[model samples]
Target: MARRILQASFVRRAALSAGWLAGLHTLAGCAPTLPVVVAPINCPVSAEQLARRCQAPQAIANGATYGEVLQLHQLDRKALRDCAAHDRLLAEMIVQCQRTILDYNDRLVEINRRIADKP
Candidate 1:
């Protein structure tokens, strides 16, 4: 009777250990994912986009009366101001992009210099 009980207990422990090992083996498949590669940023402002964004408003007709012409001049001045503001913004954006490119180039040059100097 004692020998039979011992045999049964050994069988039960062995079965549990096998099941645990099998579960761990299946779980190992979840690791080791592939790395993702990213493309470089190429955000150039297109000519078509510039043409569409900063277009001038329709031309105003010449006024008949002196007061009317003065009011028209005011309107024309405001339109010019708006156009100038848009142009300044575009210029600033171009300068900023140039600065960014130059900054990155400098960094890359430094990195290359350091790598070349390494033993």
Candidate 2:
């Protein structure tokens, strides 16, 4: 009887260990993943730069106005769609453009926050 009890306890411990290992394996499989290749930050121009250029005298002389914002939106949408259809290299350029614009905007937002926080 004593030997049987000892064997049963060992079996229970083995089963528990197996269960724990299986759970860990499952958790490892579900671990969050990050992109292996980070997007490059090689943008020469940004959305703000584009906006400023669009407001320049040449653009204004071409009949640009405040209401031309809609036209800008349409142009941007068309360019994005074209980029989406481009081959891998062009597509990467498009993504880089987007990242650069976003990085610029993030910096602009931080600057605004700091200005607002000034006493």
| Positional deviation of residue 99's Cα in model 1 after best superposition, in angstroms | 1.1
Clashes of each: 0, 0
Q: What's model 2's overall lDDT?
A: 0.65
Error of 1 at 76 (Å): 0.9
Question: Against the hidden reference, what TM-scores do the models get?
Answer: 0.50, 0.30
Top candidate on lDDT is 1
Model 2, span 17-102: residue lDDT tens: 99999999999987654324334456654455334322212223366676686677677777666544544445566788898879
Alpha-carbon lDDT of model 1: 0.72
What is the RMSD, in Å, between candidate 1 and the native fold over all Cα? 9.7
RMSD, one per candidate, in order: 9.7, 17.9
Full-model lDDT for every candidate: 0.72, 0.65
lDDT of 1 by residue, 1-119 (tens): 99999999999999999999999998987655333422344546667657855445445565567776777788777888888887887788788878877876776777677657655
Positional deviation of residue 32's Cα in model 1 after best superposition, in angstroms: 24
